[model samples]
Target chain A: MDTNTPLAQTDPVISDEEFSRFCEFFYRKTGILFDTQKKYFAERRITDRMHKLGCATFRNYFAAVRFEASGEEMQHLVNQMTVNETYFFREDYQLKALVDGILPDLAARRNNGKPIRIWSVPCSSGEEPYSLAIYILENWADADRHDIEILASDIDSAILAAAAAGVYGERSLQRLSPDLIRRYFTKQRDRSYRISNDIRDSIDFSRGNVVDPQFMRQFRAVDVIFCRNMLIYFDDQSRRETIEAMYDCMSPGGYICLGHSESMSRISSLFRPRKYADSIVYQKPFE
Target chain B: MALVRRAAAQIAEDQPSGDLVDGQERWVADLASADASIRRRAAHDLSQMPDAVPMLCAHLANERSLSVRSIILTGLIVNKSPAVVTGLLPFLGSEDANLRNGAIEALQHMPDEVAPHVVSMLADEDSDVRIFAVNVLAALPHPMVPEWLLQVVLHDPHVNVCAAAQDALVEAGEPDVIPALEALADRFPGVAFIQFAVDAAIRRIRGG
Candidate 1:
């Protein structure tokens, strides 16, 4: 009731019960799971949202999130809770699995002569699809033997344009070795870098929403998908729908690499979990 | 052979022309197509039609292809209604584990629609059906989930059913449910695992 008190000071603390309740609700709504270790991190965001909405208590904020018909509050909470940072090779272990394990299996299984297609949904600013291209060219021994098509898509058209522009700052290129950087990038005067035109031009970048059946239908016979970290933002039904759409587009025996935190087992039983390199990738069974 | 860029137009050209058709009757008819892929595509498309719910639910029983069955289940989830819940409830008693589990998974996504039926399911005569109901509660996001689990713990005669509810309670339970969980240990005395699970649920609820 102290109006003059700093909002932070007056904000009702999220109790352990409230946190547990919130975590379960959040996890069920969005696939992202927050554990005990993330208690402070989760509380900070919840309180921030509560403050923004002028809700003085966690209970009221949660009620609005749960019962609000428009789901506008839930969307706001999702944006606040998600970390959308992307950089080249953010989780390269899966990339290692791709060139080492996934590609070879696909190559061996291919009897039909067609291009090996890989798709990166929610490609963000192109770090992931670009990373896929670099890794395949540098590592896959059969890269020349197969015509590979790299398709990159994101729901954000602005990000798709940025991905098409193929520029990055020093922070985004931190994981690249100096030699790989020199080989693939032209140093910009502003101290940023632009990826080589060959790499950039070879990737087909487009705007796509993974949950849209119309957009998802455009992709077919995809051999591998790097759909990492994107599904964590979707509600349960959307997540299930997206995964099923991905299943339909992919070639049988094709592989899907989700974020390290994401699990196909939790979403659907369609894919078989396969361990490759240090990471586990889910594979569509050969029909 | 090297890295190549294919235009989205070309990618679209590669798909079968049959898929481009979006007629309701076409898709409904395709649901019975001999080709599993056609059936799957029909199931996927029919998800957008509210009236397709009954047909999609009907297809689940005869759809042998796991992929097609999965799509039908998704269609049912997309069109989730009281009718969808009623359609799926029979699967709780199914002899097919996959169908039963798929129904449970689909039901979990519809908390409001499924909430009305949970109590009756928990009170079902078959212990397996009661356990399956608990399985649905495990991932269900309804606020009443904790109360439902507490009811199962205190009153369900089957230990396996109580155990399933206790496991779900670890995430959904509240401090008030601790008494029932404690009493659960007494209800199933000499069952070492029951005592252990009850203690675990209590610790989790108490935030220890």
Candidate 2:
């Protein structure tokens, strides 16, 4: 139980068989691939958690992860394993495309008085969906004319709590212009900043995973989905299933946006690729 | 292997190889001395020797003292050798916070001499390595950086990797990169960040 045990005294190695077990367990739960090349990374992250819990080997830790009574340890493990680095106006051009290109087109096609609903899946710490709200309020002249709803969701409950709290450190504000910072965020006494209530209240935040079909089915008529940079973690099957789910939830003719590196052609043929002046996006085919 | 032999031969021809060996032995022993002060001081002094990078990195595995590991890590940071980056890879997820941070910091700041290694490390299994490689790419002016970053933005599995690549592309991407960026936009239809990163990169390249 001593924290000061010498490196030689502690066993830091993970056997190939042990590593495979971890990979299978991870994929079964998350649908993300953990290949052999990631053996070094996988071993080390597991070792870190193992060392923390005083578990001497990968097998002991695996058993704890699998059989932990409350599942809190499992949640913590997922939290530690997943990376969530995001900021405001991240990939601002995509927002520009949505505002300048996609919005008007969707508006033009609108019938009845239905609200324009946008979902930001895995909306880490609220920066993304809030940025969307800020972008519309600042640039879209038709903002007030339509009923707008922005729903932000993520699988990590810890980050979802943070998104709900809405406080941010300086690192998260690096991409924001001084004007936007001054206008939208109030400086806190601890040097962190809190997003304005106007932007904060504009979003409906929840904890959900895209991999679950049932969880995804809870939403209907999503007009535009901003699920940027999340699919890269998914393996081929996971990616296809996720894309299919997004496709099903979207209203006919609704739009979906993915990470710049994510290619829908490789994942699914359901969404039609559309080119705008500044960006390319996918649209659900009208029935 | 050939490069290390060449470097070693060069070092041997320039100095008394026996004296160099003795000095290295002394430092290695000092790194493990019972006196905390001696261990700390030796690590700090040894880290300043670029030639000591390989040895320091090797010592990192068995070294138990967080303070000593941290000092050795700092020494590795100054080592411009591609091998040092390789040596630091295993510590990316160290249980000790300081060790992990030090390893990442060292790899992050490696000089242009190791730029080629950084490019290859972009595909490293560890996301931290890829993330650090992109940060290094941002500071490098190598001609291949932009395109390499574009490819990563388009293909890396981890969002952090893609994010870093997009940021680097925004900083250094050129007009030649526009077509590829546009193609990527089409590939990932709904991804606003990718499209935005491409747009921003193209705008900067065109002086917009």
Candidate 3:
């Protein structure tokens, strides 16, 4: 057996050229950019799927990901790669800022009596969007008076399904106080908690990606967007393109909240920083 | 492989430390170049320079190129400086397994140098760091592997960490490990996998 020969490559390991080709193909399909730093992680995940599908080589898997009509393999690959480590009220300060400052501003500026729409991109397993709904229902006096819709979306269908199910483990509710948990969740037999119907029903959960230009049109005129922690994984070009698309998706004077580690300043100058009592958020000013 | 080793040794003997430093500095500059290929080539060149070992260790913390980081780890492993082991200690808790495994492989080359650092890493707040430390000790033929493995198996709070330690103990464990496994089984009655791993380690230790 010739170990060095490309024809003899039966093991799951991907060559540098194969990885680079996959990178280009993947980025074009889904606006997520993967640099060299993610090679092993990408290979391991792609190879895992390939083995599951009984594919012998990475090239074969790449072909399936590119040419497959159903797009199931691509979705499986994205689900494996995207990190979804979020908890309820994960960044409480920012949530507090939204409830305290942003909501009132949006309420005062209402024109044509339109309902306030909030979107949570890459909402993970329902934590961020659910947290937003809970905060609004609990804190805002006019939350019931004004028709508010919360749309939570992610590219990974598996996570969207989990979000729609509204059941979460103990780890996902770490920041939620016992009072909140008791009020908002029903205890399951398996020790996990199912979010209350009131909270779950408020969110319109769907599978959508920010990089997909066609899908982002539904989110136009949204008053607030909580796209936290997702942009840190994006490459520079992807970040710029995604942010611009997000900008287009927003209503004038709409607010965008990124993860604490993510910043719009480097990515785009469209959204200006607004300092709240405890947190810094970005706002699209009325032009 | 022998010829390559000899050639590397010959380069180390003949190449001036000053020239190696200049070459390393140029490569480090190239690491930040606009072209990804330039960055990759620089990382490859630096990995071959014996004098560039410490810089390679330091650069691993900042290297964004996945291939470059992997190559730099190979450089650090081949050089086997105590500084390399210590430098890699902080990366054990990295979410990326590639980065964590790179650190582990580098430390495996110089077990004596890594011994003191491993003790501190075992006490790290992150259980993943402790797991990686145990994994390094398991890979090397070090005298400390069995004792540390037993300690982690008995005391680690995280079930996954405990499982990893017991997994390592399956190979390196002594007869004394049997009693420790029995005690661990008692401590975690609910975790069936832990019990299974404990049983596997005990059987291996008893030479059953």
**Residue A97 accuracy (lDDT) in model 1:** 98
lDDT of 3 at A239: 65
TM-score of 1: 0.87
lDDT of each: 0.86, 0.69, 0.72
| Residue lDDT tens for model 1, B89-184 | 999999999999999999987889998899899999999999999999887766677788888989999999999988877654446778888899
Give stretches of model 1 more than 4 Å off. Answer: A1-43, A46-81, B182-186, B189-192, B203-208
Error of 2 at B83 (Å): 51
DockQ, cand. 1:
0.45
- DockQ for each candidate? 0.45, 0.01, 0.01
Answer with 1 or 2, whichever has the higher DockQ.
Answer: 1
Best by DockQ: 1
TM-score winner: 1
In candidate 2, list every pair of residues with a backbone clash: A93-B196, A94-B196, A256-B190, A257-B190, A257-B191, A258-B190, A258-B191, A281-B189, B47-B75
TM-score attained by model 2: 0.44
TM-score of chain A of 2: 0.71
- Each candidate's interface RMSD (Å, one decimal) is 3.6, 33.0, 29.2
